[model samples]
Every structure is written in C-alpha cells, then in structure tokens.
Target: MAERERSVEAMLRQYRELIEAFVQEKISADDFETDYIRTFTNDKCQVPGSEFTVLEKLFFDVDDYVSDPELRDSPEDLSGEQLRERAAATYSKLFGLE
Candidate 1:
C-alpha cells in the first residue's frame, strides 16, 4: 500500500512538472495537443458534439484520467455533484489555477 501510494505520488509530481513545462511553452503545443485530443476522444467520455478547444480538451483529459482511480474504487462513492467538483478542482490544478 505504501509503495502504491508512493508510486501514485511520484506520478502526480511528474504530471505536475509536465503541465508546468507545457504551460511555459517548453514543449511543442502541436505534439501535446494531438495526444491530449486523442486521449479524450478515444476514451469515449466526452459528450458527442461537445466542442472543445485544445486547452479545454487537455484539462478534461487530465481530470478524467486522474479521477479514474476514485471512480473505479467505488463508483457509488461519488455523487454527480461530487464528481463535477472533483473534475473542476483537478482541471484547476492542471491549469495552474489553484
């Protein structure tokens, strides 16, 4: 359990650094945008006909992926409101808004 926690923490840290670097223009937006869009669209989580910009898709992708564990652990643990709250918070962090 401790190892899993540490691994998760490390992954989160790496994700944060990658996002920060991305926001700072250290990486090519084209490459990032392609992968970001692919993840969200291929995941089948987005509503059909939902229009999203590159950044918006990135935010949603991160939030959706990060929240997977919580969702899987206990699907009934989170209400719709709670899930939205979690997604908002996660998106904020990914965007350096919090």
Candidate 2:
C-alpha cells in the first residue's frame, strides 16, 4: 500500500514538472500532450509496483482533464498566454496541487 502511494506521488510529480514546463513555454502543448498520452495511455504503460486499478483511475482523470471543453475550445478565442494560464490552473486543480 505504501509503495503504491509512493508510485502515484512520483508519477504526479513528473506530470507537474511537465505541466510547469508547458506553462513556461519550455514545451509546446502539442508536445506535452503527446508525451502525456504516451506515458499514461499507451498499451504497454506501467508504473512498476503501482496498483493497476489506482493507475487506471488516475489516467482516466488525466484524460478528462485533457478533454475539458474549456481548454479544448480556448484556441478559438484565447491568446497564447491566456491558454497557458488556463491549462496551468486546470492541471493544478486536477492534480490536487492547488
């Protein structure tokens, strides 16, 4: 149980770093999305020693975050900075980091 918790925490930390880089323009949204999907959704995706069920739930939550309409439709009207801010806020909230 403790090991599973640690794995989840470590995964979330990696995600936070990726998100912060995206917010800072160190990585593009497209690139972030690609990496995020590959990390959590690929067929062979695995977090060693993590409970499969727990990881699955976390991945689903992230998927919902990615598909959020506010973020999805923002490109229609929002400026680059605005989009980044929105993404940062959403990610922080989703990850319980806010």
Candidate 3:
C-alpha cells in the first residue's frame, strides 16, 4: 500500500510539472486545462474525487471509486451527456472556464 501511495504521489508530481511547463511555454490556460482534463479522465489509474479539483490542487487524485457513495450512488445516472456537462462545469470552475 505504501508503494502504491508513493507511485500515485509521483504521478501527481509529474502532472504538476507538465502543467507548469505548459504554462511556462505560454500555452493558453484554456488549452492546458482542457488537455489536463482529457488526459486525467482517460487515465487507467482509476483515481477518484473531482478530477478538476484534484488536478487544480496538484494532489494525488485517488479514492475508493467503487465504494464511494457519490460515485456509485447512481452508476447509471450520469449519462454520456451528463458526464460531459459535469466535466465541462468542473473544468471551467477550476480554470475559470477560460
């Protein structure tokens, strides 16, 4: 379990570095945030919590996805459209929706 925690922490560090580099390279905040959201959502790591908040805070975004009430409460509730809407809203709030 300790190893897993270390691995997750390392990944979060790498993500933060990548975002920092993008910002340094004069990339638009909107583009950076969008890419971050897409990469995070498709990650095989299966982390939990609000991806937007986790990424914004540069924290290891792992949680009990299977056991979390918010996540499992309505497995069939968040449809594709709803997911997209939620993603967009979260992303926007985190990065000021630029």
Best by TM-score: 2
User: What total of clashing residue pairs does each candidate reach?
Assistant: 0, 0, 0
TM-score (all chains, Cα) for each model:
0.32, 0.46, 0.38
Instruction: Tell me the TM-score of model 1.
Output: 0.32
TM-score-best of 1 and 3:
3
The best candidate by lDDT is 2
Enumerate residue pairs that collide in model 1: none
**Model 1 segments more than 4 A misplaced:** 34-98
Which window of 10 residues has the lowest lDDT sum in candidate 3? Answer: 58-67
Model 2: per-residue Cα lDDT over 1-98, one tens digit each? 69767666666665667667777789775565566667666535346643445445434434444434456653344444554666576566546454
TM-score of 2: 0.46
- Pairwise lDDT winner, candidates 1 and 2: 2
Give the C-alpha lDDT of model 1. 0.45
Candidate 2 stretches with Cα past 4 Å from truth are 43-83, 94-98
What's the candidate order when arranged by decreasing TM-score? 2, 3, 1
lDDT, candidate 3, 1-98, per-residue tens:
68766556554544554454453544444444456667666666544445435564422211111223455564443332333344344444444444
